[model samples]
Target: MEIPIYIFYALLSAIFAALVAIFGKIGLEGIDSTLATTIRAFIMFVFLLLVSAFQGKLKGGITSRQFAFIVLSGVAGALSWLFYFLALKTGTVKAVVAIDRTSVVFAIAFAWLLLGEEVTLRAFIGALLIVIGAILVSLK
Candidate 1:
């Protein structure tokens, strides 16, 4: 059976996420977290623009609702990065990443509550296990 393309992208994202923590930690030695985040965001913006342009995906025809949601998502992502960098600045990478990964559990809950997504028993159990693991890893 062939895996989906999204799986490969997700795998790559995970790999880059690990690299981001290491690189961000090293690069943040004497820098403000907000400034570091801004620089990183700018680099990401340029890279994504290049990719979008290369793929001819830069058309601007989104609906107002789509634009609003995209703006909201960008703001939320910026806030998440800001807090994540702040945490990483003071916390060990392992613990910080572990705690951050608990966003999966939060996503599950939010999906069920806000998106009306199904929350099966198995998924609930898995999310519970993730919660437990995150808590264990976060303990000093």
Candidate 2:
């Protein structure tokens, strides 16, 4: 994909995610978080399935390695959501979200150390900025 297209997708994803967190907190007023997560998963699965089908790529030929990766992704996603919802339950939305977005710093560090991604000074500076912004947003 083109660079602009990727940026567009990222922007939309971030916006949608922020909206999800806000609405999710409101919707969780009378529902269990775990159940709510499962329902959201079901909805996402359906949407993804439709997209795959429309693209003529609906196939389930998963190898063990691919299966493991998928499982790990799902586990990480569930854990993240669990913590997000729990935090939202007890903390302010802005604080919970700002803290949660700290994953960008974590991602940068892990990618550098584990995946051997390039650890340029620029990347370090960007991560620092993200952390600073998160801290400022979470301040009372």
Candidate 3:
């Protein structure tokens, strides 16, 4: 829940993501990207379920509203994956990831405006650098 924890998580996500790109590129050498994605999704689903059970968080207490939101989240995830796969087909994984990671900018802006979070100079600087880096990467 802390900001630093989020940053650590993001860094770890980036590391895993690099591995994903390399592995996916190799895995899809002959198979279609869609098939590869489906396989990965299934594995991820199983792992997430196991993690949820391990955390004792799946006590069959989900409300209908929670179920709705969970389904919506899954829908959004699928849509995101569709676009990501399409991007991977045409662009280097690095470029796609660079652009995708700019979601941090949106998160910062949203927190500042909607959540009333403090807009620290460090956060502003980091967001600026990230956007500029993404632009540089996108320029070819």
What TM-score would every model get versus the actual structure? 0.95, 0.89, 0.75
Poorest 10 consecutive residues by lDDT, candidate 2: 1-10
The sequence of per-residue lDDT tens digits that candidate 1 reaches over residues 1-140 is 99999999999999999999999988889999999999999999999999999999998589999999999999999999999899889898888998999999989999999999999999999999998998899898
Off by over 4 Å in 2: 1-3
Local accuracy of candidate 3 as per-residue lDDT tens digits, 10-46 = 8898799788777766676666667777888899999
| Alpha-carbon lDDT, every model | 0.93, 0.88, 0.82
- Which regions in candidate 3 have their CA more than 4 angstroms from the true location? 1-8, 112-118
Clashes, model 3: 0
Clashes of each: 0, 0, 0
Model 3's alpha-carbon lDDT is 0.82
**lDDT-best of 1 and 3:** 1
Q: How far off is residue 56 in model 2, in Å?
A: 1.8
Candidate 2 residue-wise lDDT, 1-140, digit = tens: 45778888999999999998898889889788778777877888899989999998966588999999899999999888877887887778998898899899999899988999998899899889988988999999
Pick the winner on TM-score between candidates 1 and 3.
1
In TM-score terms, candidate 1 sits at 0.95
